[model samples]
Target: MACMQLLLLLCLLVSLCNCYRMFGRFSRIPPEPQSDSAVQDQWFEQKLDHFRGADTRVWKQRFYVNDSFTHSDGPVFLMIGGEGSANPAWMTHGTWITFAEKMGALCLLLEHRFYGKSHPTKDLSVDNLRYLSSRQALADLAHFQTVMTEKLGLGKRKWIVFGGSYPGCLAAWYRLKFPHLAHAAVASSAPVQAKLNFSEYLDVVQSSLARNDSDCPNKFKVASATLIQLLNFVENYEKITSDFRLCQPLEINTKMDRAFFLDTIAEYIMDVVQYNNDNREFEGVKTTNITIQVVCGIMANESWGSPYDRYVEVIRTILKATGEKCIEASYKKYVEEMRSSCWEGPAASGGRQWMYQTCTEFGYFQSSDSSSQPFSGFPLSYHVQQCTDIYGNEFNLAMITGAIQQTVENYGGLNIESSRIVFPNGLIDPWHALGINTSLGTDIVAIPMQDAAHCADMYPARPEEPFVLPAVRKLVYELLTKWLQL
Candidate 1:
């Protein structure tokens, strides 16, 4: 039951990333919440559109630079921010900062073009969101590199790009696109492959649960089976409503409401699993490290309650932790909230921006259609429906498929052609479903961190963390040193 707070932190923590969209803010949103008293804010004048030369539109992109440990002609380590505010703490902290000190490199963390304080558009309107894409973000990195080199009077210093999660994709892609600008890349938990039917997301989640406690998956499976039964029977509808303690009575007959109710439960569990233990905290909420293990133990304890009841307890407890009176089970309200154009609620925290990105480009929708997975309420169709509703009718399944095809073709997807890039994926991280988890070539290497969660390797090695993380960090440093020829 203590794990409830951690799950609450998962959805409500704006500094991180999850809101029924993807990743726990899917761990892309709020960066690790650190005190910014020592951090200085810096901004870069960037072109909104890099593709069109005629468009002179520009935006002030936020960034932080740490040259405390620098040398003339030393390498520059640029940590790319993903789908959230760029924290200056990365420039000072993180495993990369250690490498920066060892190699006498200058550290920089650049905010994504439209995220955080970097507003490339006046509003997150559909028309303005067109400027936001991975391609454009990559171009921003390219231009930023040039700006830094000239602005700081650094002559031809080797630039190593670093990113985790989505930006991890950006780092690897940046290296591939502008090899001359970026000498090497460290893409941790980088999902390079653009997947539509990302049912494997839950596969990893279930596996992670089983890893903590083997019977935990069985509990969830049994619970899901019971839930399926409950949803199927009209007589059990009241029991379902009473058991979950919904604020609004669930429209049991409506397909959308049923999905909303079941998916809401599945989502809380999925969020906890996806970002199980990356050691990130936001606002006043705590990290999900110890809670994940605790939750697994609770899940398997039959003495506590039945499997379905325990499952409901997890959701109910989490909702209670979030300070909600009851479950907001209105699918219509949820859809309306997502469809809202203003930069409040989901829009303010980059969820809306990222949703638009997913709708237009990367459809990394995590559904529970896979038979091997424990949960089964949220399917690929649910995501497709949300996308169509939030964006427009043009954002249909066929269009999304074509867009993903174009993205994969453009970036090479799983078969990305690149060199001097290290893709470090967590063994338990569900997002690694679309990441390159194997060695591609002599230069493009994949390091799988066992018992690790998303971007675990990116953080600085600590004694209490898993042994693989420290080893992975050491390897990343050695790779950077070798690649930079330091």
Candidate 2:
């Protein structure tokens, strides 16, 4: 389940691009717990609107810089921040620090606009969210890089952009959109495609679990069948809701409520499978070496109890694994909050900001369309309804569909043809299916880490690190070095 925690973390960072919405599933509110602050806090005055004319409003953009490993003539490693608060711990403990030190490079971590302390407006209203986009954020990176270079007196130093998950997508696109700005780019687990009804995501989850234990997928299928049967009967709904300790009884009026219930289970499984990191605790929860295998074994054991009972136990187990217990399970409550939540005034609204992105640009909703898919109850309609509730008349299937098509056409969609970028994805990462998994050009490379989890290569190295990660990092360094030489 450690991998799930990593997935949750990745969602906070990567979901801003596509992949999945961080708080869209269940009541998994509150951003993943961050590590201790290690880097100095600093802010840059940035323009409110990068493209639109005559918007002179300036906002404080949060960033952190580390020049300890830099040399006057060495390269600069820019760690692109994603959809969450910019944690300085990355500066001290992330793999970029190690790579930067190895290359004697300066490291700078810049938070994306509307995320963390980098707010361009007072709130996350629709008007404010109009300015929150990849285009503007990419512009922010370019402008910030130029300013930092001048401020630090680094003249024409080679700049290497580095990021994992969503920022990773940005890193690769920066090279494509602003080719001259980045010498090379390392985009680890970057999901470049903006998809609607991203059922392929669940496919990766199923495949990863089955790879660990072949019987695991069958066991999961049985559990899902049991839940589907149980939930289909209105009489069983109240009992099942109580079993899951839902704050309220499950509603039978709409398919959305049932799908929400099933998604809690689906989200838990997806979270653990993608983030299955063995060596360390994640977000203060204990993570096993083979979490999916262990959970599958437990769920498959018939001697313990009935399949439905065992499934219930598995749900409880997953909740406990994340250091959380029974939560409010009302889909209606979620919709009500989504509609009434204030994105204005003070406080950082990460979830609201990202939801707007999903509504506008990338409808990467993780819904299931097949019986083989675990969360089969969550059809694409559930996602559309959620979007409608959030954005009112401004959001709909037609509008979201248009945005998806435009995003794909403009950025190469699933077929990103950018060069001078190294795209590394873990086979187990569900988001890998949405990214560029094969090289389409001479300078564009895609390396799949066989047993690695989401963005495993981007984290700080550990004694228990997978063998392929170091190999991939070495390749990334070689690529960057080769690019610099040219």
| TM-score for each predicted model, relative to the true structure | 0.90, 0.90
Which runs in model 2 stand beyond 4 Å of their true positions? Answer: 1-38, 278-290, 340-349
lDDT of candidate 1 over 1-486, digit per residue (tens): 423443343335222223423333365444334667777888899998999999998879988888889998789888998886676667666778788888888888999977777888766777888888999999999999998899899898899999998999999999999998999999989988898888888888888988868888879899988998888877787788788776555576577677767777677777677666666543223434434676677787777679988887777666565444566566675665555455444444576778888878888888889988888887899888888888889889999999999999999998989899999998888888889888989789999888888888877566667778877887888887787773
Off by over 4 Å in 1: 1-25, 31-35, 232-248, 282-285, 290-292, 316-329
Q: Where is the poorest 10-residue window by lDDT in model 1?
A: 13-22
Over 74-162, each residue of candidate 2 has an lDDT whose tens digit, in order, gives 89998887777776767776667787888899888898998777878765566667898888989999989888778889899999899
Q: Top model by lDDT, which number?
A: 1
RMSD of each: 5.4, 6.1
- Given candidate 1, what's the lDDT at residue 330? 60
